[model samples]
Target: MTISMNCKRFAILLIAVATLGCGNQNDIGPTGRVNGVLTNKGVILSPHTQVVFLHSQGGTAAYGGTDEKGNFAIDSFNDGNIPIGAYRVMIQPPESQLGAEDEPSAEELLENSNGRKAQKKDAEFAFKYRQLSTSGLEFEVKEGENVFQIDLK
Candidate 1:
């Protein structure tokens, strides 16, 4: 009985030590770093831009933001790396119609008897890039670092 108890305790200790050494395994599998610049007809975009990478498998999407220089890095799964796969890229400008400022406030809508008028502004650039399907932009992320120079016509 004594020998059996000692053996059980040793096994438990070994398992505990092994588990501690291995650390947490919550990470998403097989990711790669992606960095890129956004440009329009050879001109670097300075607006606050958001770049989204929709995975071809139709699940969680990875995204990043651009600085004044239009540089961005894609992050997914709460990490700085994105899962290695093909993605349809979508680029959104700073002042999109879906922006908070573009939408009428609840009070303003309530005050207006005619309801809210749909305000349409002339697009500065081709707005088709805002949609993944219409963007015509595709990128394949590999295991490791990737650099892309995205140019919009």
Candidate 2:
């Protein structure tokens, strides 16, 4: 009976230590929680759309995925906050929807032998921000919790 009690106590102590090591949001210094909604002419974006924020000066980048309602929250490593910086944003779709102008997969995107092949569904009907340099959507993320409603042109 005494041995069982000791084991239980040991397990509790181990769990407590692990929980404490997980850290809290307040512990993340010089970072901010970025929450935003992706919109196009006041309409919600398609589900599973991805957003990328690349630091203009380089070295840091943040990514987030949108839901059906177009809401998204960007965080570092699924736990920490994104470092404060000016980022050029790119709101993109999945590979199957890439079409021709943006090229194909990783290997195809790198090659320049051909320009455009297939036509995209949204090529003319809608606007798609796919390139880092041409996204034209710039945002500055500051400290603490930052929120923005990004409207794509």
Candidate 3:
């Protein structure tokens, strides 16, 4: 009977230590990392583009032009206040550089600008859409790395 009691206590201690370790393993830094590639079909993009991370509740996070190899990373530190929900990802090719020629020219966009005056703008720019193919996707961000590979076809 004494030996049996000792064995049970050892087992309980082992289990408690394991549970504590496992819990601590997942508690990483408050900052979450997001990384991925953007591609259309099999070819990687050549010019610069913009990537936007939009929360369902109207907040946003933005990452900019990837390298020639088409890779991007965005790291953000939160107070862990992000609500659990779906988030929309958006991509916008820079007005100065785009894949297609028929696309509108950035010069044309600022033609009326005096270089010091504000132009008409709204949430549309924040959620701007460059082309039908480059629109963002929706993803849920947990407490770890959120990787997203976008395939616009």
The per-candidate count of clashes, in order, stands at 0, 0, 1
Ranking by TM-score: 1, 2, 3
Which candidate ranks first by lDDT, i.e. highest? Answer: 1
- Superposition error at 44 for model 2 (Å): 1.0
Model 2's alpha-carbon lDDT is 0.73
- Select the stronger candidate by TM-score from 1 and 3: 1
Runs with alpha carbons beyond 4 Å of true place in candidate 1: 1-27, 95-122
TM-scores, each model vs. reference: 0.64, 0.63, 0.49
Lowest-lDDT window of 10 residues in candidate 2? Answer: 117-126
Better of 1 and 3 by lDDT: 1
**Model 3: per-residue lDDT, tens digit, 46-93?**
546666666666464545565677786653344323333466777776
* Order of the predicted models by lDDT, top scorer first: 1, 2, 3
Clashing pairs in 2: none
* Residue pairs whose backbone atoms clash in candidate 3: 89-136
lDDT of 2 at 12: 97
- True lDDT of residue 84, candidate 2: 79
Instruction: Report lDDT (CA) for all predictions.
Output: 0.77, 0.73, 0.58
Better of 1 and 2 by TM-score: 1
